[model samples]
Target chain A: AQSVTQLDSQVPVFEEAPVELRCNYSSSVSVYLFWYVQYPNQGLQLLLKYLSGSTLVKGINGFEAEFNKSQTSFHLRKPSVHISDTAEYFCAVSEEDYKLSFGAGTTVTVRA
Target chain B: DAGVTQSPTHLIKTRGQHVTLRCSPISGHKSVSWYQQVLGQGPQFIFQYYEKEERGRGNFPDRFSARQFPNYSSELNVNALLLGDSALYLCASSLNRGNYGYTFGSGTRLTVV
Candidate 1:
């Protein structure tokens, strides 16, 4: 079984400020990592994914995550954020592609 | 080019009642999975179906059952629903049983009173 740990429960940042969301995982076998953003009353939208490639993977909305194999961490970062970036974010890990274990989630509030 | 679509965006039911949620996977998608998201929590895996067969199931009890159709659509049926069953039910679709990432639906909000 695989599990995810999102270290921060909530992150607050001002508009145009940089932010980072930390995530860690533990699994007996290799796994896939993903970041998803959920707006109010909406489904989760994929922010980025790390399958097998360069350690640093980039996704939509100017978000990028580095997959650190040694630390077993995949931290998401954005150099500058906008007010629209305020939402709940989730970090998920999967041993099998069909089953996913998600973290409790982190609420990112981007203020003006 | 529609994404995964779920029916009855919102539903209200009473305890001990049975509820069935529906989902239509993306065109050409062969796998559909169900998840439950309680308030203020992340979504939990419930079940997954591929090619009209059960491929994976979560820790949920037998009271929670699901099936897929030939068209790749799926239905999740919860019997004797409890108050805890009141949550957002999400449906996701993938191209196959492989490592392809999943595309999720908007989800059905099931509220049990």
Candidate 2:
């Protein structure tokens, strides 16, 4: 079985400031990690995913995440944020292949 | 592409009633998965179907069921609805039942009153 833990429930940052959302997971086998962002009343949008080969994965909207196997972590980061970046972020893990276990999402509120 | 599409964006049902949610996967995608997202929480997996067959299931009660069609569209049916079942139900489609990116639909928000 696999489970994900998001360190923070909510993170607030001013526009143009960098931000990081922490995520950790526990699994007995290899895992695939993903970061998804959900706008209010909207579906999830894939921010980035770490399948294999690369530990540092870059995604759309200038988002990136690094998978640390030793630390059992995959933290999402952005150099700078915009007001439109305010959304709920989710971290998920797939242990065998398909079934995904998600964390309690982190709500990112970008202020002006 | 049309991305994943789920029907009846919102629904209201009474306790002990049943509800059926619909989803149309992206064209050419053969895998569909169901997830339930409660308020202030992330989505939890319920079921995964691939090639019209059950591939995986999450830690959900037998009251939760799903099926995939030849066209790869799917439906999620929940019986004996409870107030705890009130949440956003999400449908996701992938090319295969693998560790790949999945396109999700604007979930159906179910309210059990």
Every candidate's fraction of true contacts kept comes to 0.62, 0.89
lDDT of each: 0.93, 0.94
Q: Per-residue lDDT for B8-51 in model 2, tens only?
A: 99989999999999999999999999999999999999999999
Give the lowest summed-lDDT range of ten residues in model 2 chain B.
B94-103
Which residue runs of candidate 2 sit more than 4 Å off their true CA positions?
Answer: none
lDDT tens digits by residue: candidate 2, A34-106: 9999999999999999999989999999999999999999999999999999999999999775788999999
**Candidate 1 per-residue C-alpha lDDT over A2-79 given as tens digits, one digit per residue, 9 for 90 to 100:** 889999999999999999999999988888899999999998888999988799999999999999988999999999
DockQ of each: 0.70, 0.85
Residues B35-85, candidate 1, lDDT per residue (tens digit)? 999999999999989899998999999999999999999999999989999
Write down the RMSD of all candidates, one decimal each: 0.8, 0.8
TM-scores of the candidates, chain A only:
0.97, 0.98
Name the best candidate (by DockQ). Answer: 2
Model 1 alpha-carbon miss at residue B99, Å: 1.6
